[model samples]
Target: MVDTMKAAVFQGEGRLEFEERPIPQIERADHVIVEVGAVGICGTDLHALKVPPGTLSRIPTGVIMGHEIAGRVAEVGEDVLSVKPGDHVLVDQNAPCGMCEMCRRGRPNYCISIRNVPGFPGAPNTYGLFQDGGLAKYVRVRELNVIRIDRSVPIWQAAVAEPIGVGLHGLRKVNVRVGETAVVLGAGPIGLVVTALLKRSGVGQLIVVEPLELRRQAALACGATAVINPKEADTVERVLAETNGTGADIVAEAVGWTLDTCIQVASNGARIILYGESELDDVIPIAPTLIGIKELEIYGVFLAPFVFESARSILESGTLPLDQIVSHRLPLEKVHEGLDALRDGRALKVVIHPNEF
Candidate 1:
């Protein structure tokens, strides 16, 4: 094994340089060293780079950028027994200590102790943002972050596992059922994954709302029966009319940029899932009286917990065209190109290959 490995290091805001660093040795018994094969570009990563390096800027210069990756264990320490060297796997970016209140409750995504704070004792500061990333030849995996995958799942598609897991987790908790109609707002990767899961989960009908022509078209490809361009029509009125004027049975707001989009577009008793981040932008306006009169269930899906396995099942089932959502692939040296593409909305999901680069 080489003493040094290739890593795409983020030196500072707008400064990404691919360089060589010493291969991280297993610092703990439970740690595993993985030779990273692929990592996907996520929107939040781009948002971090754009907005004046606030919380994410704490990441410091020389941090690796990608968490979504599939690789094989090159080495596992003495305490690591769940997997072996040469085993194909995808690492969970979010983690919780088994003894923490959140983990004890089976909601590991909200791991109280390690919740989003980088540089925890044995955690990777890079995987979920703080240190080095997987846009390199190797990534060090903390015991909790690693999951062995089916060797058959393509390394490229396995990158979908994490994001898809998030969608599945929300649906599992949303209390959805077959024969119900849902309106998935937002046609990004996660949005499309949610729609695909809803269809495979047997929803009666799905109407996807997106202003982007490309994303709206992709939504249909992901099994949305109808697509609505929010910019082209009155979304609320049209949705109500499409659902026999009663509105849909469920409304999953995948576009969370503003609160306005989360308005009730369902019948008297309906479930509205706030699955998108844009909802963070504006206050959701709706009559408090309506929520009371209609008996509504509104849920906020933060991330996945205890649902990676189900997500893998959905991906393995080939329920959606995972291949199409990913629009570009560039070498690690072209990290800026990938980030730029994401920033401009020119690509949806782009994979980075440090090895190939």
Candidate 2:
């Protein structure tokens, strides 16, 4: 085994430096070392790289930046028993402190100490953002954060489990039912995933709103019955027209600042889930009275709490058109290009192979 490995380190805003980092070793009895095969460049990574940074500005400089990770276990601590060396695995980026009040109440997703809280101890928080992650040849993970996958599954597909889990969490929160009209604002990666899941859940009419023609087509492939180009038409009117003037039963804001559109297109007693959050400082104007008058239920989705296993199962089922979703696959060195592609709306999901080069 080599002593040093190449890693992509965050260098403040708008910079990612390639550097040689020491190969991590198991410091704890439950620590596991993984030989990284693939990691997905997420929207959060792009947000962190923005000038002045976006919502993910809290990500410390020098941290390796990739959370959607999948690899084979290279080593396991003495106390680790669930997985062994050579096991294919996916890493759950969100490692909430299990002892927190929110976690004890069965809501680890709302754990106050999920992130590195000041003066708090043992807050694993999240991988890639708060700590060194898998945008490198190797990553050290706690056994609790590692979930073993079938060896036959491709590493690239496994790497997307995190985002898929996010979609699942949002879908669960909205309590989607069969034969309902659903409108997804934005056909980005998360929206596409949610569209696919909503289709699989038997939604009768799935409408997607996106300005980009490429993503609109991708949304159709993901089972969207109709797609609206917000740039070309009034999104709210189109959604209501698609639903025969009743509007949609469920609305998902996946474009991060389309909450207004989601609210405008939702039917009475509809459920809305906000899945995109790229900017922490962004605030949209909305009519609060409409929420109560319409009897609408609005939910803000955070990290995937308990849907990792289901996400993996969905990926393994081979039901989704994974090729349509993963638009680009680049080596670790070209992560900048991947980020650029996502930023420019030229790519959907970009997977990075850290060990390929």
lDDT of 2 by residue, 214-257 (tens): 99999999999999998899988888788999999999899888
Model 2 stretches with alpha carbons more than 4 Å out: 116-124
Question: Which stretches in model 1 have alpha-carbon errors above 4 Å?
Answer: 53-58, 117-128, 278-284
lDDT leader: 2
Task: Name the top TM-score candidate.
Answer: 2
| Residue pairs in clash, model 1 | 10-62, 64-133, 125-131, 126-131, 256-278, 256-279, 257-278, 257-279, 258-278
Give the alpha carbon lDDT tens digit for every residue of 1-357 in model 1.
Answer: 569876777666656676878888888898899877778877657655653543423455667778787778889989998889988778877656677666788766666644543444334244736656688788887876778887777777877788888787778766788899898888888888888888887988799998888788788888989999888898888888788887777788776653344456767788887776641224656567777787877877766777777766766667678876877878777878888877777877888776631
| Residue pairs in clash, model 2 | none
TM-scores of the candidates in the order shown: 0.90, 0.95
